[model samples]
Target: MNEQDDDRDGGCGAGCGCGTPGREQFVSISRPSDAPSTAGAGATDRHTIEQAVIPAGTFVMGDSSGDRNAGDGEVPLHEVTLGSFSIDATSVTNDDFARFVDATGYATEAETFGFSAVFHLALAAPEEDILGQPPGTPWWFGVKGADWRHPGGRNSSLAGLGDHPVVHVSWNDVQAYCDWAGRRLPTEAEWEYAARGGLDQKKYPWGDEEPDAGGTWRANIWQGGFPGTNTLEDGYLTTAPVRTFEPNGYGLWQPIGNVWEWCADWFDPNYYRASPAANPTGPIRGGSRILRGGSYLCHISYCNRYRNSARSQNTPDSSMGNAGFRTVSR
Candidate 1:
């Protein structure tokens, strides 16, 4: 409980809840179509509401694999039984979010705050030109005009990236989107259950297999280096289109490597010890909400938490270039 206070609530875009105001003005924006109709041409087509049913079963949770690198939060591998529930097979895409934004004229927390965190590489501007950087990670720059539409900054666009997961979305933004869609964020247990994809106690979405096996690149992750340069050996400098890789046993796409998805629970490092045997919903209150799976930025040298048991935390309103969410239904 003495860890760095997680940003569970009471803030704006991606920080300790301090930023710009005047969100009511967003109502002036008119609704638009579902992302220009060409978001995913010749790409995998799936219903926006399509979901896979995760059957009721008991599965081992956390790091039982003896990975010395695993964090303390992943320890004491326990068992959890969850009832039948359904979840979106993929992270919410730009097109999906576009419909929500158009319908409600909802300005994301980032837009309301007038800025959001962008991967430092995204700026490509002279160091002096960048406005500022977060205290913890300088790699995360606070770039002006960065939101869901312009993920990089003022100049970027979601043109061909419509099929990609919508980033620069705060936890609050995802909650509103889920409510409008008549869906809910998955609990940490449910998320890990679905993420395991019927495979019990395995690292990554597919058994213990390495991401790049047989010279076939798997998930989209930093290839060459972290914070400085990326060789893009995995065919992406940042996010790749949803369904870019094969699905897991439960027909889930990119379960391990993609934008970190928000979970419906307050994060506690010690929660697993007392987690329910039937269905655990995490702590009643905490500093931060839970984030699962790794992102395009995850690498072995830094954050390698792309496994079924790996977990991370962030403030409820925190939005990042590598953060996104999915939804579930009872």
Candidate 2:
């Protein structure tokens, strides 16, 4: 990556993959525990996660559309072959996480850190719970008591959000969830392959058509002015239910938009230049982990990465309201 590219990546922290800014002021330096928990041994029994079984296939990976982010290493589109795998039909929901937490007694990194990134407009806690905002991005605030349960802050609860994809989960937290559920995050290549949904290099899972084709919204994305005014044209100001949109050919729902989903790969913009054609996992080591599928905050003017081949990265321990993850069978 070039100097300017480095600056752009640094500007947006954990949540910026979906347009939510990161908290640079309060960096989460300490890593969370990765030990597997014996609890939740019957997690599969409690929640029968619907998974889409993608047959082994080869498809071009990376962006062919001109919408690719500059310097995001989405260039030099290459063919990738992946083996058959089963992935959750939708992003992990609040109910799923709640079961894991209740069984394992696990505390997400955000809960351990005592604060997490929350969009300014979505702030639901008392003024005292508001910590501060990052330097460049004023729309994000570091709010205390903001985790998966209290997504909007201390006052927020998962009362009506049981089906919504769980937010405020860090990459490390996902590890715990996977450990309990006996699953793993999909590789970036696997994610893109399934996200394509049998289509070849299409801009979206459905097609190259715009998200709002013929005045009908396909995915949940920012409909109006970003950060300032959201007209709610897409029927939601924030995240919609995990299964809100139409399923792709592979029966995956909302693969491109709604919330940024975590991937099992360390990011390297230049890795694609030398990536193996068959089942390429990211780099051997890197500071940040991969985040795919931009969220509702995405707009064409800013962070328009809500596409099949778009990519973003953040530190493993950072958590925010617009990011979550789905899992593949181990």
Which structure among the candidates has the greatest TM-score? 2
Among all candidates shown, the one with the greatest lDDT: 2
RMSD of every prediction: 8.1, 3.7
Task: List, residue by residue over 145-173, the lDDT tens digit for candidate 1.
Answer: 78899988888889899889998887778
* Model 1 residue 138 CA deviation in Å: 1.8
Candidate 1 at 16: error in angstroms?
Answer: 16
Off by over 4 Å in 1: 1-47, 68-72, 124-129
Tens digits of per-residue lDDT for model 2, 210-310: 99999889999887776788888889888899889699999999998889999999998888888898999999999888899999888886667888988
CA lDDT of each prediction against the hidden true structure: 0.72, 0.83
| Model 1 TM-score, all chains together | 0.83
TM-scores for the candidates: 0.83, 0.91
Native-to-model Cα distance after best TM-score fit, residue 142 in candidate 2, in Å = 0.6
